[model samples]
Target: MSEKAMTDIRNDPAAATRHDIALSIDKVRGVLEALRFGSITLTVHDARVVQIDVTEKTRLHA
Candidate 1:
């Protein structure tokens, strides 16, 4: 199978405040592109994405 570019955002915030700080698709795409190739883990707390970690992939394909 061919590899396809994709982004997965896991919304772990509370139900009520989930819609308060919504990220646009374009913004998200730009963020991912800026990081180049790697893995990013979004850390969320209190209905907000507080941190981002860009780590290199250890294996050939992960």
Candidate 2:
């Protein structure tokens, strides 16, 4: 998601007012949870979370 999208989600007080919006937010949360062990990058503008990026890593054993 772009910074604007993230910001909109974060800043929107009516997000939970709509079932679809709430579900969408929940889906995003799920994705973040799944990527918990991965590298996460948060871009902040004015001390607010604006963007998130996740990078997963795998280890190979001989």
Candidate 3:
């Protein structure tokens, strides 16, 4: 992320209100596409996602 982008996210109150659902969804989408073998967990409270957890696994071939 660029410094300008970081500043923009911080400066725009609407972009960050309630943990920024749009941004969270975009991030989740990206993670979903990139992950092959992993678990995506969303921690929510009051119908809002508060945290995201990504656990990736490595499989060894015999």
Which candidate comes out best when scored by lDDT?
3
What is the per-residue lDDT of model 2 for residues 13-58, given as tens digits with 9 covering 90 to 100?
5642353445546656867878745676766575445566778877
What overall lDDT goes with each candidate model? 0.54, 0.63, 0.82
Candidate 3 wrong stretches, greater than 4 Å: 1-19
Query: Which should have the higher lDDT, number 2 or number 3?
Result: 3
Q: Write the per-residue lDDT of candidate 1 for residues 1-62, one digit (tens) a residue.
A: 12221111233334324433455334556678877567777777865666666675555655
lDDT of residue 13 for candidate 3:
73
TM-scores for the candidates? 0.41, 0.42, 0.61
lDDT (10s digit) by residue, model 3, range 1-62: 78886787799876556347877798899989999997999998866677989999999899
Worst 10 residues of 1 by lDDT: 1-10
Global CA lDDT computed for model 3: 0.82
Candidate 3 TM-score versus the reference = 0.61
Superior candidate under lDDT, 1 versus 3: 3
What lDDT would candidate 2 get against the real structure? Answer: 0.63
